[model samples]
Target: FVSMACSSSSFPLMVSISGVRGIACRSITPELIVKYVAAFAYLQITRHQKDLPITEKPEIVLLRDSRVSGEWIERISAGVLQSMGANVLSCGIQPTPTAQLLALQRSNAVGALVITSSHNPKEWNGLKFIDSDGLFLSPESCDVLFQMVNNSAYQYPSFEQRGSFVDFADAAQIHIDTCTSLSYIDLEATKKRNFKVVLDSVNGAGGPIMKSLLETLGCKVIGLNLEPTGVFAHTPEPVPENLGQLCSAVVEHSADFGIAVDPDVDRCVLIDETGKPLGEEYTLALAVKFYLSATEKRGPICKNLSSSRVCDDIAKEYNCISYNTPVGEIHVAKKMVELNAIIGGEGNGGVMLPDVHIGRDALVAATLIVQLLSGFEGTISEYKKSLPQYQIVKLKAPIGNMVPELILADMKKKWEGKEGVTLTEGDGLRIDTSDYWVHMRKSNTEPIIRVIGEHQSEEEARKVCEQFMSEIQNWKAETSE
Candidate 1:
């Protein structure tokens, strides 16, 4: 919700509902890490002790991604938790979802902290706090934690009362086992197909577990950037432009398809057999279709305002209603639980299955993709072609001195009471027309305004985005004048 734009010379730290992120050694120093961790631990300890016996110390699951500073961050984070009289269950170099699942499974665990920048460049590092229910902190909880940080409201326990630390090495395998054990997976049938997959982990935390999961499901893996070095092979967003290498490799190896995951392995993208990237929006659409077709249990579907409308189309086909919340995985996940949604996720290749735990998980997404492909007679691209098609264009504009709220307020006024245009406000401004929709919101992870437009065709989507981008710029100009 913070609108201050991020720049190297200006404020480099980004703390929002998503978590805290900044350039390593610059804005995210050891002191900053300790302060945040201590505050989080204190919050968890006080919040949970009331529900439990007095003798029990709150347990926290701590993990990290493949950033170069992850190790030291983990050490400092663990030390802070221990000093605050909270036991630390350290799972070194595991995906963010894995840590969330572990936290949910541990009955004594009150929360978790993941040291990851999650698809950011290697120079960035941060923390993602997960509550006992295995979801990110809600907005209200985040406000309380930030207040605690600002007030310096943390206390350390005596030396004898400090908590213990233990290493948990089986977290990745546990996540794989959970994914394969799902009844809908049909691992044996998928294994019979003997899929040839080209996996690109970009040398992040997902490399080992993703490869292991594919092979366990009887895939012939052609690994790229499999090592968990902090250095990435390319930009780590897993977008189309950043995945040229994976596309070429899939064609060169003549593989069935290629799979790409972000650094934390929460988002999953695919390259078809023809060496073409399926836009990230399709990851959720395909997963929803597959789940609906494969199961008899029907429920509502939830997605973010910025996600493609194809999900609504699919939901209607199955006689299920679809709901849209503000942008953020936690928002979607909470809505899913409220609606008992069978499946929900974001548009950025994040798929959340409540059965597998309420978090965006690449392992679950990849497993669904493999199982869905195994039953089909054609290639990946063909399967994508058969689904409801829509073009989604995502663009960002810098929010210079102008306030995002004022701009969004103006947009609401401009589009309000139009023929078929409906405006949705709260997180940002979303204008839904008869043919298309455009959502403008402040980025939770970065310092800019994210403009997402979707329509039946690429041209129309781009046009809508450009029109709105021009309008926003003009507003800034008028304000300056």
Candidate 2:
């Protein structure tokens, strides 16, 4: 019998197409980073070898957020890729989506690696892999790559065959230029507004890029945590509760609105002119309104099942169709690709525009929101009030030792015949009714089951969430007993 101790059991490491995430130096050590980065490069070389030209060397773009551990991870990644005979294009401390966009521009690029943990705590840092097409890897690709990592199947070239490195520091400029040149962005109109705006990047990757983009649009910027020092001003998620400083700053500066991005700058949340957060969900909702209104081609809009139904409402208003997949930005992105969705994203401030890269882009979201505001007659608060109002209550409970399958089955039986109730079980259990919907899913990044309920009224949403929370608590207690 063999007994092996695991030192990282307490700090769980998560591996998915999104990337590997865990506590730095614990589950996500330098050694692990090198292994995974090598695995990624190997998979790309192996899978895409036939498509490559013999004379062209496979190139990869590497980027990182402002997390303190990012530089060390970047060094390990660069070493692994170079050792494996791939050319590296290093775009230091850029937004997650910027890495993806830059990948598409490289003719010989096979993939890109972004070192970021998004909204995770300061202690956590990770990587997100972008394919040559500038999209996150699909589940099938991820599965194959994981097998390679497990088997330690990676190539190490001879000294003479080692790859070369190039400093590609202009990713931020490329992103801004691309966003500004998009037909939807009213550059002249945005500039004429001369809008005063406050930006809080949480000392992550978004600060410089967002400031540059907003300034180009002629907004007077009052920036907070503009330095990408990795020392976060507060909790880094950009949720309403975590954005009190931004809210206060918005009012203090008399800015038109305040924008906040998570550590990696993919998700964007907004604070209104009146010092009220528009909620992360509104970021996508308003962008949908703008994008759909501007585009002539009417197509289906894609969103995750757990995303706000406001997306559906907007699509319906445009006389377009709306479709949903399971949770995760990749799911939404893939669905958008399949359906050729003109606009879509998750409720957590992710805006996926096929016109810009397929990944969730906070920069794109901010640009689109400003375009929407440019044509509007009132403040963001008033504009928000014009839309359909839905209250979403989110809660999480520890999974403990309970079997999620049994709990889901029980939930299905209990709500099976109830009028106006519908059940879904793919990504955990989701119960939908005419006016309210509740989705309970085991979090991919955390050890808890997230319960979310949305209704037209705050009271009803709260009630629905509480009911489900209580049920889960009861079931967990019974299982432990």
Candidate 3:
């Protein structure tokens, strides 16, 4: 089965198993989808190079978000996966992190298929594969998946041996329970405060559980986009400009604070009682603070290359360490496994703890936020007032698929000998200086090159990113001409 649609622009820029995302149709076709899933089934079933486990039939967890097409595509994937002798547990229309956590808790499931394109538009959808360990499939697994897809070595189970599907709505509740079980929470204190809360789910899968978690924490909840209808009122990315509804509702209802989760709810950003956006980076930063301070059992923290250096400050207080990995949850998760990290996440507002599985969980993050607010007994604004401050300017522009590598090369050459420039090759090119850092990365989900700069002031951050962006753009144009 030749797939003519698999090209640089059309094919998904698949990362490790958990992050294969891109625009729909162009990136993921029906045939390609089935073959890849079947290939995954092949790899999981064959993972035991030793004697196969007693569970002759491998089990898989199948889940999706609120995207209307999620059901159709998931049904197709289940058919192919089931055909390959993989029993499927359906946690229908769930958040991405929920699927991963459920896969971890279910003794029978060996992997999970999470259908989401995250913050991408409605026309887009994706498949994120998670292993039995609840971590996204490793880099090696993806290589094997693509090869297996091309090899046609997939073994389809016989009629009687074929696997079956079961409806497991309880999976979400199980996930919620596991998250609450983490030692970080003081539910007595949180419930005693009786905080007021407002939330914008962006009409995504987060609606089902984000509000539920808040209510369970004793928050007086006012929720927008709670219907789970996928009729997005904003871009669904939780950026400040797009967060007007959440902020306004916070003030209108006079809520203690407001929260925003992207479509899948794996990431969360915040707004204060004043209706002022705390932005995404602070979500991770606060989580780190609460996580590190919660117990004396401090360990190295893991963070992404594109994230703020606030973790550096937080780590200093504990005399613990921080390891910066590539800008993806899997990379951070791998490092966490290596370092036994206490907490870690991306600046996109995702937080992962070893207590739970390795994934960005909005519910866990929200729980941390509430705990912080409870511990301090102040508004979100007051709690954030004491943290170290830096202004990060985020920018991006279109670049051809081939240009990113060239731009990275030029950046290294151009900034290498500069007195202030120090470089780290984590994801792409992270050029550091005495007081700031700039990272230019090729986005896994989009065609644009993302340029991020953090400095003491917004003006300085802008200057850094603009200079780098201009130099790269001009260099690429000249090379093409």
Q: Which candidate number has the best lDDT?
A: 1
TM-score of each: 0.97, 0.97, 0.94
Candidate 1 per-residue lDDT over residues 139-257, each given as its tens digit: 78888888889899878878987999999888999999999998888988999999999999999999999999999888999999989998999999999999999999999999999
Q: In model 1, what is the error at residue 110, expressed in angstroms?
A: 0.7
All predictions: root-mean-square deviation over Cα? 1.5, 2.9, 2.8
| CA-lDDT, candidates in order | 0.91, 0.86, 0.81
What is the C-alpha lDDT profile of model 3 across 132-178, one tens digit per residue? 87888876677677677778877776888678888887877777777
Ranking by lDDT: 1, 2, 3
Which segments of model 3 are wrong by more than 4 Å? 1-18, 48-56
| C-alpha lDDT of residue 458 in model 2 | 87
Clashes of 1: 0
Error of 3 at 231 (Å): 3.0
Q: Per-residue lDDT for 472 in model 2?
A: 88
Residues 1-481, model 2: lDDT tens digits:
0111223458878776566788898888988888889899988866665668998888999999999999999999998998888899999999999988888877888989999899989998888878888888887787777778889977776798789999987788999999999977779999998889999999999999999999988889999998999989898988888999999999998899999999888898999998999878889999999898887879999988888888889889989998888888778888888988888888999999888888889999989988889899899999999998988888888666767678888888898988888888778888999999999877766557889999999899999999999998999998888
* Global Cα lDDT for candidate 1: 0.91
Task: Give model 1's TM-score versus the native structure.
Answer: 0.97
